[model samples]
Target chain A: MRSQSRIAFYLLLTPLVLWLGLLIVIPHIDMLLISLRERISFGVYDRSLLQYEKALTEPLYLRTFARTAVMSILATAITLIIAFPVAYYIAKMAKGRLQQVLFLLCLIPFYVSELVRTFGWMILLRETGIVSNLLQWTGLADQPVELLYTDATMMVGLVYTSMLFMVVPLVTTLESLDDSVIEAGYDLGGNGFSVLREIIIPHAMPGIVSGCIVVFMLSLGNYLTPTMLGGKDSLWFTEMIYNQFIVRSNWELGAAFGFMLLVLSSVIVWGMLALTGRTLKETMG
Target chain B: MIPTIPTSRAFRLTYGAYVALFFLYLALPLTVVAVFAFNDSQFPSLPWDGFTWAWFFGTERPQIGVFHERGILRAVGTSAFVAGCVAVLSVAVGTTNAFLFNRYEFRGKGLLYVLMLLPLVIPGIVLGISILIFSSTLANGIWDLAQMDIQALRPGLLLVILGQFSFITTIATLVISARLQKFDRTLEEAALNLGADRLTAVRTITLPFLAPAMVGAVVVAFLMSFENFNTTLMLVGSDAPLTIAMFDRLKEGSTPLLNAVSLLLMLGSSLLALLVILFQRRP
Candidate 1:
């Protein structure tokens, strides 16, 4: 009977395993192989490391990579800074339906597609748009601003898009935190700020770190937000990979760029796990 | 609990201001989209001439003829069809996989779970491109064996469905798995001890317990597939999906029609979510 049940279990597992293997694992292996090859004309691979060498040594590619990393790191930092207070407020202060309402409001933006949200920012930040108009109306600027196609706008869109992902985990973790810990700190004669620093922040550190990692990963993989809001000059690293494949038709180079992204993201995931002292499985579980 | 400190009107006012300001920031864009949908103007962003349903109804006027572009509608239909198929397939596969994972212990179980979730963590662009390459190669090999000429298997609906199912199934599996963990095993054991086969036990005792979770998983999968832009963009054929269509239209310039679509989608999704919530609340 045990052997029969085991057979049934393996049978149930077969299709899903095959589906993932055929679509994900095998394709990833192909990408790895393609990354090692040379880019012949018309985007075909020519079985060499010529493309990888060029991608590694090219200043343009290197600069774009560094710029994307810095921008993603900054965006992650800004999101955490903004989200931490909101999560804390919701977890600690708000009660009952009000908390649910506020949390739902945070989730509403996520319900809409990212493309639409990014377009909303584009309209608001355009030269003749609301932000510029408001700045001019308030006498804060002498002229209408050109903030639309810049790193600042990209940062705004990235942070806005990723804010909910950061907040949800923080709120869940903070909700699980015992209020008595903070009360104990206070009973020990610690002030409000001191209690927050000594007790609440330490308890929430794991969530904070995981939230940052998620935001960073999403931001790094995000090509659409930067492309739409930052315009042609933005040329984010993923956008560069996109251009190589779609516009330039340089498959080998695109594969190399993709592999680099994979490696970078994997390293970030590993570093986050080490820092938080938890595996990915633990976090997801 | 710490006693509440009261009698600070200034601090309350400051907090209120901050909350209000952030709420406005969140709602401003959605408000713009909702309002412009009703504006009767040539350009989408300009002042409202009058209230009209010309964009939504597709009426023509001599001075400014109504834009009769059915591209968005067609793309919406295509996306709906693909998302529907993806939802069904993913839920079936995911539920089965979740049940298997939950009910069994085996060698390499840890590795299997990780492999299942790898697609979720990988970037969509990478997934789309890799799938494109792999599918094309597979199609070519099959064609070579058949000795028939075929167009390059670059992009199409099949690829889109396959691409979406890759990650969406994982999401369904995770959600259903969570629910399954809460299931009471003794009920199934009771059924089994009463001379029911394993299949009969599952059908009578276990499936009813899993029905609500299965519904939620299906809805989530459908929504995820519908709103998916990144993977869809990469894998879509010559025809665009609604999100892609709207994006292209925005690239040209903003229009109230886009706003019209946004309002419709928002209302639709809210209603759908409400229905699900109501269903879950049912005894």
Candidate 2:
């Protein structure tokens, strides 16, 4: 029986070991190693930081990287602001069938693929899109105003794509908070704004942090939305990474850029958790 | 719940309006996508020429429907095939990992579990590139040493499968583990003590219990795999999945046939999502 149990244990351990170890861990370590090396000649290499140096020194790369980070942060903030009230209403204010229905509505768009979602945005924002047509119909515009590719358009797409991620976590955390806690704050000479600032926000911090982390990472990593909505001028850092790896076949440089993104996201996630006094286990779990 | 903070009529009206608009914002893009599928125009966009079904059923010129477009149809098949493979593989491994986490108290388990989730945070692009670099390097090394070329290591369907499986399995495990944690272990133990072998007990009792969650995980994994663009984009070869195919076409510019495809995809995903939601509603 002991032997059987041991065998079963090994059976379970095998897949986890191979899946995480072979797929996730080793590849990342290897990417780091590859990023650190500089190819000198045929079948020869030198240990160097050339890739990192290039990423830092190149104006285009540096600008795009900074832009991606800033844009992602902005997107996260916007999504949070937008999602919080909605999540609050769903979790606390709404009741019964309406609550379930509202939550489902939030989720339905997400079930549609990102590509399709982005396409939908494209259709609505293009010169001949529904909005433009509506404008033309209202005689508000003499000509079709092209709105498909712009920074604002990209932001909208990013926020739209990320809304559900923020909402889901926010709703989960908010729903668990007792109504009396908020009521007590209100009863004790607190207004809605004050109560929310103290009681609700504090309770929802973990959800907020998790949601922000996810939205930021997603917005940061997002390739389709920005490229599609922002056009060739998108200058997204991920696009740079793709250009390096696929277009230019510069794996070393691409790996460096990839590592930079990884580190940046990790630091931001760590920063959010630390600032909120939460741990990865609590937030992620 | 009743005697909460004083809510003025104005405030309530404003809040209700906000909720209404928010739902509209959520619904509009997708609604437009679906509505345009029936728009009888060359472009997917506005000023509807008239309502028509050519996007789905037409077979000539720009009006060629998604069904008639061999490339689109083929890509859909590829996407479905990849999703199916990814779903099955991720869920199987996920179930095993769930058991590993839930049943064991091994040293470094916490660390291992954290490592398992590392994929979730790693940007899909980076994940794709890392696997691409590692596998190609490994493949090259093998070729140099053993004079053998490994096609699977190159950017292709196999790598796409591996790339998606890496992260999807984490999600699958999370979903399955949630269900497994609630499972009464004593039922399996009782079966084992009452003359049933351990395997039989697990097969008949534990698995039957886990079926709902497992099914839900499968659907989630499948949809995720299907909709996956970032990682798949990096690893895809000549045969692109539906998302990659749609992306490529969208870059060139879109036609209403793409709308047709989007409508079909939305319907399919809604059905799958409804199934999972219905399953969750079960006790």
Candidate 3:
């Protein structure tokens, strides 16, 4: 009977081990090797840190990587600022039906593709788009502003795209907070601000940290939003990687860039976990 | 436990206004997409150029409607087929994984579990690149001996499905394992004691309990696979998915027809989500 159970366990385990091992682990290992090697001739290669060296030394690659990191951090921060009030309202303040509806409002947009959502922003922020048209009608400017292909536009797109991720985690954490805890703070002559600082922020810290991590990773890795919103001048790192792989066919450089992204995101996530004192299991969801 | 926060009238009013604005921020862009689907304008952009169904259906220019566009339709079909395969394959493997990891204790189990989740944290673009590089290279060595077609193992729908499956299966496992953690072990034990063998115990007890989570996994996995663009872009070669096709068109310049497609995608996904919610709620 024990042997039968053991056989069943190994049998069930086969699919997972095969899938993850072949598809995920092996590929990543191959990528690491590819990232390490330099192509010498048509099919020949030499082992070197040249790929990493080139990526690090090259001004365009390094600059875009930095830019992507900064932009993602800024986007994460802004998303948190925008998401907090709404999450607070839904999780803590709103009544049953209203809360569900408000929550649904946040969720329904996620039903649409990120491509579609970003496309909608293009329609709104383009030179002849909705905002420009409104400005023209109101006589705000003689010429329509070039809202697309601007850094501010990238910021707006990033924040907009990442809002739901931040909000959901915030809502989840905030929903678990006991109302009496906040009321206790309030009853002890604590004003709203004091209660917020004393009770609410502490309770929501794990959510905030986790949400920030998720948003940061997404915004950093995001290719389409920046490319669409910021156009040619987007200067996102993923675009650099894309150019390397497809246009340039420089897989080595692209692999290095991809590895760099993996490292950067992992390091940041680790830092966040350390700072917040939350386990990976606790924070990942 | 969630409701009844202590708040002043001033805070209440302010919070209410902020919430309204926040909802607007979330809903307005989506609303714009839907509204432009009906716009009579040649361009997808705005000033609400009178209402028309030309983008949805019109004889004057058939290609102006997304459904009329051949490339877009082909992509839609490809996306559906790939997503269907991915959903089925991922759920089967993912559910089995959930049970294995949840019910067992073994050497390197913790390490293996962490490794399983690596795909979730990895960027889709990277996943695609890695898988593309890995598979083609692996196939290069094996093809001569195995006498298999290289294109089949190359970057395309098969690679796209594999790339998506890596991360998606992790999600399914997480969702299922969460459900599994809440399950009582005694139910399976109860079946076994009543003369059912191990397989029968599982089929009658464990599998039935996991059905709801498996259903949710199907929808979520299907949507993720369908909506995926990053991994698909890296791995896709000749054949295009809807997101990739639409993005290519948008880059060249698009019409309200793209908006129509966006609206259609929204409607389809919303219906799926609604079905999942209702199905889950049913006793």
Candidate 4:
């Protein structure tokens, strides 16, 4: 019976091992190798960091990388600011059926595909869009303001798209907090700000960290929303990587950029983890 | 029950308005998309010419609606096929892995657990690239090994499935394993003592218990694979899914037909999500 159980265990484990080892781990290794070696001919290459140097040295690539990072950070910060109140109201104020309904209302929009969601934005912000029409109708402007390709719309799209991710985590963490703790602080003459600083924020740190990590990674790696919404001048890093791989057939350069993205996620995730003092497992959940 | 924090009437009123505006922001874009699908105008934007079903059912060559458009119908078919393959492959592997990880103890288990979750952390684009590189190299190695022109194993639908499966399977495993961790183990032990074998015990006892999670995993896997863009963009060779097709249309320029398609996708997914929520809360 023990031998049989052991055999069953091994059988169950083999598929996962093979799936991860062969597909994920080995591919990442291959990507690393491809990134390191510079292609000399159709089938020949040498080990060098020329791709990395080029990514750094090229003004276009460097600007794209910096722009992507800055926009992603701004998106993350803006999402947090916008999401906190709604999350707080749901987790703290709203009760029973109202909370459930509101939470579902927040989540239903997310059910639409990301691409579809972006398409919805495009419909509204195009030259003949309602916003532009409204401006013309109000006599605030005589012509349609082309809002589709601007940074404001880009920020709006990023924040809007990621609101659910931020809110869900914050709600989960905040819901678990004991309200009496806050009441006690209020009763003891502590003002709203102090109570928030001393108790609520401290307790909700893990959720904040997790939500920030997700929003940051999402906005950073986002290709569709930025490219589609930000239009021609978006200079989104992901688009550059996509261009390298598909358009230019520069796999080595693309692989390097992909690795740099990996590095960025790791760094931001690590930084958040460090600041919050949460372990990888805890923060991820 | 916990009492909420105290606030003044002014604060409450402001918060209420803020919440209402938030909901509008969330719901407005999709509302425009849905409404504009039937708009008689040439464009998807405002100043609706009149209401018409042409966007939904156009039968002409260039002004084709979503349904009549052969490329769209074909892409939908392709998306469905890829999603189906991914759902099945991922769920099978995921269910087995979940049970093993949750039930047993072994060497390197901690490391394996982290490694299993590594795919979720990595972006889809990176995974797509990795798989593309790895598979092409693998095809060439096989060619070198056996003087056979077996290099037809490059990018295509199969690569799409495999690339999607890499992460989707991990997600399914996480879902099922979280459920497994909470299940009572003594039921299986009692069944074993009653002379039932492990396989039979698991089939009758554990499988039923895990049915809900398995369903959720399958639905999520299918939907994710269907909607996937970045990875699909990288790995897809000649064939384009609905997302790729829609994106291509977007790049070229959009028509009300695109809005028609978005509205359909929105309705279909919202209905699916509603069903999941209803069933989840059906106790």
Best-fitting candidate, scored by lDDT: 2
For residues A92-191, could you state the per-residue lDDT of candidate 1 as single tens digits?
7788899999988888877777776776676678886667778888999989887888888888889888888899999998998887777778778987
TM-score of each: 0.94, 0.98, 0.97, 0.97
Q: TM-score of the candidate numbered 2? A: 0.98
* Model 4 chain A: worst 10 consecutive residues (lDDT sum): A276-285
Which of the predicted structures, 1 or 3, would earn the higher TM-score when compared with the native?
Answer: 3
Question: Which stretches of candidate 4 lie above 4 Å from their native place?
Answer: B1-5, B61-63
Cα-based lDDT at residue A249, candidate 4: 92
Off by over 4 Å in 1: A39-46, A139-143, B1-12, B61-68, B149-153
DockQ of each: 0.54, 0.74, 0.67, 0.65
Give the winner by DockQ: 3 or 4: 3
Candidates ranked by DockQ, best first? Answer: 2, 3, 4, 1
- Candidate 4 achieves a global lDDT of 0.86
Per-residue lDDT of model 1, residues B26-107, tens digit only: 7777776677677787555544578877677765652222245567778888888988999999999888888888988888
Model 3's CAPRI class is medium
Candidate 3 lDDT over B93-177, as tens digits, reads: 9889998988899998978887877777787888889998898787887876897767878878889898888889999888888
How high is the TM-score of chain A in each model?
0.94, 0.97, 0.97, 0.97
What Cα-based lDDT does every candidate model obtain? 0.80, 0.91, 0.87, 0.86
iRMS, model 3 (angstroms): 2.0
